[model samples]
Target: MKIRVLIADDEQTFRETFSRVLMEEGFEVTEACDGLQAIDAIRKDPYDVVILDIQMPGADGIKVLRETMSLRPDTRVIMVTAFGTVEMAVEAIKLGASEYVMKPIIFDDVILKIQQQWRYRQLQQENTELKTQLDGQFNIDSIIGEAQSMKHVFETIYKVSGTKSNVLVTGESGTGKEMVARAIHTTSPASSSRFIAINCGAIPEGLIESELFGHLKGSFTGAHVDKKGLFQAAENGTLFLDEIGHMPLSCQVKLLRAVEEREIWPVGSTQPIEINLRLIAATNKRLLEEIKEERFREDLYYRLNVVGIHLPPLRERREDIPKLIHFFMTKYNSEMGKECVHINEDAMQVLINYEWRGNIRELQNVIERAIIFAEGDTIKVSDIGIFNAAAIKNDNDEYDLHNAMRNYERQYIIHVLDKCDGNKSLAAKSLGVGLSSLYRKIDELEINGNRKVTNLA
Candidate 1:
């Protein structure tokens, strides 16, 4: 879309010439004779840039600027003034005029100012979009679970989000401990600020102190410049420490002091830096066990565990499998640009009965892979690749060879069909079978009939 411009001035020659120049430069231009006409034009339509003269009949530029601010505050208004009334132009800026241009207005300079304002507006729009995406991703609604355990977790998050106490989240590796921490931060009073996270296990023991508490110039071998720590970076927001059990015993002492005193002493800095931020820590290791083994400090554990939240593994909450599957399917469908709408009944049953030792993270990966390989709107048992003999055992715990062979045949036929893009003739050619036989097998195996097939010469 072309940039829309409105030129309001008492001089007809100046207004006509400016409008023509802007139009020639690929802008959509409108003209107003005076301040009253400018206000009327603004009320009728919104413009990307407005150029108004300070002195005009019927009304002044200041009144027009106020009206524009009240009606369309986003419109970038540039006040045009002569040498005598430059002070009034300055006053106009305080009243919300975006810029002021001295008369005889150099059209190129005015265009440059308009371009700068346009760029600013574009940046504002991009920032708004990014913030919206972040809010949608981390909000409570984005966390999918309907089980009682998950409901309890949500309740705890809501209760503790309003407080300033430190939170300790305990769970298995893939149970989404970090996700819950983000939900807490997103809903907390400090949501408008940052959320800084660091993995204690990933950082080297020698550098963990400097990484958390910062370092002054020449404090260490590589400390050539002043560095800010996670605590200071997360001021007024949230600092999430993942795998806190891996923090060294020496660093834990300083961390305890920082948490208790609400301050940190940077390396080589004598003065302590006062900090205020909510602390959330997560760990898969049992801190109580670590404490018994003398690896984790008991006092520090208690301090960080003022509020506790535990996420159950996927196997423990089998009832939520269907919801989680559907959620993941929708997410991957949009991301991968596929039309997978649902998981077939047999596929869902296998997923629910199987042991998800890796928890939600593993489930998410499986679903993403299934969506990518699935040939139709419906996800089939073969698409998920869970048809092993051990998984398809009889009630008596015996391997069912007959059922296993049937499943293998089904999976192979689907694979061939997918490779052929649902072209049954080509699939039969690839499988060394007649088209009629392939159709009969498809019927016998109960393959999805809705799969789109294209015929090519």
Candidate 2:
């Protein structure tokens, strides 16, 4: 990442000289003549380092430093003073000045100091990323969900991942079954290793065996070079076979043998190679019915289904619709560089009430497409086609039993909070909630980002 620095000094000579020296060190520098100017710069763009003069008009370096620290503590501030008073500089340091620089700063020394600060910032960022990943124990429990049917699905993944047994994740097409596999691998002891995924249904049957197992040189028509299969590549890791229901019966036997023996035989190779892998498979079809109809193997099905995790369709998780919409809006806003913030109440109601037959995946695609075409800062009713007035009213008027009436307004508020990425104050203001009550209500609603369901070592 580039080093972004802000230089705030009243001395034109000092600002020009310091700016040139820092730029020579390959930092992106923004210059400000006073504390007020510095604050304006900070407000406009995020900076990694701020070199502030101790004395300035409108706002002093101390106030700018304090405000900057509160807004973005990650930013480092280096105090610069022409007439260095040791006591004043010491107080500034205590107030959050990263370090103090005196007048007549050597150009060489200037580069060295900025480089050190930049390195320190990088190390801190890396530590934070690692810590977040480490402390996050992924599990279905962590997903922000509140539907009874979805709750049962999450519980199933939990029970299954705890055991070393095989898991068969059954769900309709577009349901997040692959995510379930990832949660399992991340929580398991094999987390540090690779999590290799393959779509058994998508791979051609002729190439399926070689793809799962290794292939020696000259083993087949295109076998000019030897290659390690996904199983070996994911040694001691996870191998998620998606659409296992579509796997050929012949291929199923080889997969079954590989799972049972914990080894594999390369194509046209006699020797079998041992593998340390965990198996998690997913399918959209009922294997038992397929087995009864002689389209699937009962023995294979039994082996794969030691523990079953059946993800209910999206329509079943109606409570999560508002959550998903806001999540997608945030995603689109960041990607499209749009300042788009909240979703309209009336428009959100359209999404909640719609029958999402295609499930979460479809909903995500719809939201992405809608946001890309959105015209305003806040997502308007007309931006997405879901809020068509006539169609929306018809659906509302036709439903005889409005008994399952949704808390549309409440849901919208919760969704906005999530969209702000869990920033309580920002979420509160966006949702029109008072700062003091926002957190209270978030806890009341139990609306925290759910940690992904994963296995623990």
Candidate 3:
């Protein structure tokens, strides 16, 4: 779109010449004979830049500028003034005019100022639109679960997202604590700014404090330049601290002060910088235990725990496993250009029954691995690969004898059926069982006939 320009001047010759010049320069120029017409034009249309002559017959430039600001503070206005009224023009600028142009106006300077203001307005609009799109994408439903526990988490996120309260998320590793933090930020009032994430455990102990509170140039060895910390970086947005329990006690004191005072004192700087950001912290380890062990500060724990959101481990929400599997299968199929569209009931059963020691992260990894190794359109028990030691070790005390035997029987039937090219009669013959018995077993195991089998011959 062409940049829109509005020229409001009492001098007919100057107004027409300016309009024609801007038009020749490819701007969409509109003219107003006086200040009243200028206000009317502003009320009726949106202009990227408005020019008003300070002295007019019907109404003056100062009156128009004030009214324009009251009506549309964002509309960039340039004041045109004579040498005698330069002070008045300066006052006009203080009242929100973009800049004052001395008469007789220099065309090139006016064009440059208009272009600058126009570009700024364009960038502001684009940024606002991008923020809206991002906020829409980071909704609670994006978490992808329907279990009661997840439903509760969604509800908590929804309620807490609209406020300025700090949030502390607790769950085992890979339980989507960071994801929950993003969801809260996306739905919050400050969604337009930024969402800065830092892992407390990932940063080295020597630099963690500086990383959170920023550092002045030459504050410490190898500090080649000044740096903005996560708090300042997340201005008007959210700062997500992952693995917060891993933060050292020394850093915790500074963090606690920052949280309490809503300001930060950078390293090697006496002046404190005030911060306006929402803090969301997450940790897999129990912070209460850390506090008791004297590894974490008790006051910081209470400060961060204003609104706690606990994400349940995947094993505890087994009911959502199938849904998650389907979600991932569809996702990977599109991403990898594979046609592995189905998961056999037995494979899904194993996924549900097995303990997910690493939680949802482990489950997603398993699915991606299975997709890589899957040979057919369907995912079979054999495609799931061998269970990891963590899973088997965790299942040792919880395994039921009957279910274990049934799982083994299902795997054996699947193996024979795949070997027989999905032919139940031939599979039965190879296994030394009657054809009717094989059919009955297939029905009992709930195995589908959609498996793409290899011909044994």
> Best-fitting candidate, measured by lDDT?
1
Candidate 2: residue 344 Cα off by (Å): 2.2
lDDT tens string, model 1, 292-340?
Answer: 9999999999999999999999888989888888888888988988888
Which one wins on TM-score?
A: 1
lDDT of 3 by residue, 43-136 (tens): 9998889998999978899999998999888899999999899999999989999888899899999999999999988888898788766665
> Is 1 or 3 the stronger prediction by lDDT?
1
Candidate lDDT (C-alpha), each: 0.88, 0.76, 0.85
lDDT of 2 at 221: 97
Q: After superposition, how far is residue 144 of candidate 2 from its true place, in Å?
A: 3.9
Relative to the unseen true structure, what is the C-alpha lDDT of residue 218 in candidate 3, on a scale of 0 to 100?
A: 96
Candidates in descending TM-score order: 1, 3, 2
* Predicted candidate 2 versus true structure: per-residue lDDT over 1-457, tens digit per residue: 6789999988899789878877776889899998888898998888988888888988988899998988888888888766756577788889877898887777677677877887898899999898566436244433555688777766776666566678888888877787778788777777777778899889988999999997999999999999889999998778888888889988989988988888899988999999887889999998889998988888888888888888888767778888777777777778888856666554565677777767888888878877786665555445565533222323444563342223333345445644664467887787676987876665664544331211110
Clashing pairs in 3: none
